[model samples]
Target: MSEINLTIDGRQVKAEPGMTVLEVARREGIDIPTLCHHEKLEAFGGCRLCMVEVESRGRTSYAVSCLYPVAPDIAVRTRSEKVDKIRKLLVEELMAHAPDAPELVTLAREYGADRNRFAREASFCVLCGLCVRYCDEVKKKNAVSFFDNGAVRQIKFVPEVAKNECWNCQECFAICPTSYAQAAYLLTEALAFPGQHQSVKRATKAAARKRVVIPIAPVPMTA
Candidate 1:
């Protein structure tokens, strides 16, 4: 494939045809925030926070950097007035779900997004799909996925798969932007699969039944 040259934030860079705009911009040390895009996984534009202004053939538009491909001879602006406004709205929207998320808070500061702009519907999940995508794409474990549709959608673990898989492997927990995947999994473990590992649960309950550690004060000093 021929080299693709593009201008990102006024810096000229050469990239391969398959590389997306976000990859090219990152190659040039450009900072583009994204909650969904992961290097190990395929480009998922679930979070439009990485939107950027693109000018091609005198036409200007915004595109999600993680999913949008780099076009030869196109000018890309990572930050712009319109782009910032769009990002600010996005931040505000996502913050509605995960108000206290560190990543969202940081983005709120940068984009001047007011967390309270929308009604407080704190589910503590921004639905970035980081955890779900990582679980499926990288770990190859379809243990968790988005449950429901529309406004009530949330991530959930398949009780059977989670019972056998999640306890030993929690790789998705670290990648979650809102830190809700862990808690969601725990909740699912509690309610979704009641009889899963009953013996283990019973043993844990039995162990918790008031065992006083009797301290023997210095067992009779050496003869």
Candidate 2:
């Protein structure tokens, strides 16, 4: 594999072409915060917690290091006043959604973010997509997925299919950043009703359509 040189937080570093800025920074002992990134799973840059300042080709911008690819002549700043500001804001948003999430709680303390800053209705899921991606990519199952888009989006599960096709796999529940009670309730309903669920048809149609739900990657901030 060919190598490329870049500077992360003033430290010169060499990384492979496909290596993401987060991976390179980690390899170089530079810390970048993340919520949806898993070593065993594909890159899912939902959380903007890992935003880093990057300067490449005369343009200086902030990028989510987990999905941002390293290139030659690139310069990265993991911790700066601007970067810290963005990260703190991102953490604050996450706190409002998943106030009880252990990882998120710790991150909030680290960044000196207030949990009640943006607190509203308690939304357990922060839309990190970890459980959804894990079910689709690793387990090769479609038990749960995000329904709709934007602020109205939610995790939809097929009760019948989950009972049969899902085989009671709670892998996603275990890794979920929020409480698993909601998911558990759905599973219970599946077992009790057997074939009664609203999302069954939707699941079938989704499977047939095989719609490719692309993971959201952060774009670099424009100069």
Candidate 3:
């Protein structure tokens, strides 16, 4: 594996030939903010939070560092004022859609996003596709996917069937970048209440009673 020399934040750094800009920056102790870029999964480039200005041969352009491979003589600026402003706006927009997501709200605060200037909408998924990618690429379940068009698209689990394709693996719940799936489940549990499963509750009480018998012959056996 050949190495490539690059300049990041005016500091010289070297990385392997095929390393992404994010990888190189982390190695060099340069912080490049990211949201949808997990180390275990392939870069999906949906959040656009890791955008950085790259210069090569006098050509400068913004690129998502998570997807841009490092190259020799490449120059990268990760924390320019321009990059900060754009990231703040992107965080605000994402928050407006999912206001209840605490992770998104915290990220917005970190980027200095003081206000969400966009209108709110009813949406659970941030469209990061962490769930879909994990299920298909890592878990090999293929039990869920994204569907629909335009503003209506979302991640959906496979239709219920005899095989129980979902397997209740909760991969999507674990991989959700926004924590929306877990929050939704918490809300559902709150709404469903304890009385929803009356039969199960009765059976549990009966089983507890059967396990609590007072053995009359226990003292004789001990003697």
In model 2, how large is the Cα lDDT of residue 180? 42
* Residue pairs with backbone overlap in model 2: none
Q: TM per model?
A: 0.84, 0.79, 0.76
TM-score of 2: 0.79
Report the lDDT tens digits of candidate 2 across residue range 1-223.
7899999989899998899999998887888888888877888889888899999999999898888999998999998999888888888887776676788888888888888989454546678888778888998876667776575766655554455655467777677776542443343443345465664444334323322122221221111
- Candidate 3 local lDDT, 86-164, one digit each (tens): 8999888877666655667776777878545787654546778787787778878765566775767665544322014
Whichever of 1 and 2 has more TM-score, that candidate is 1
lDDT by residue for model 1 over 1-223, one digit each (tens)? 8998889989889999988999998888899999988899999899899999999999999999998998789999999999999999999998877777889899999889999999876567777888888888888888888776565766666766777788899998788876677666665554444455764464334323312111111112111
Error of 2 at 178 (Å): 1.6
Model number with the top TM-score:
1
Weakest lDDT window of 10 consecutive positions for candidate 3 = 214-223
Residue ranges of candidate 2 with Cα displaced over 4 Å: 149-151, 181-223
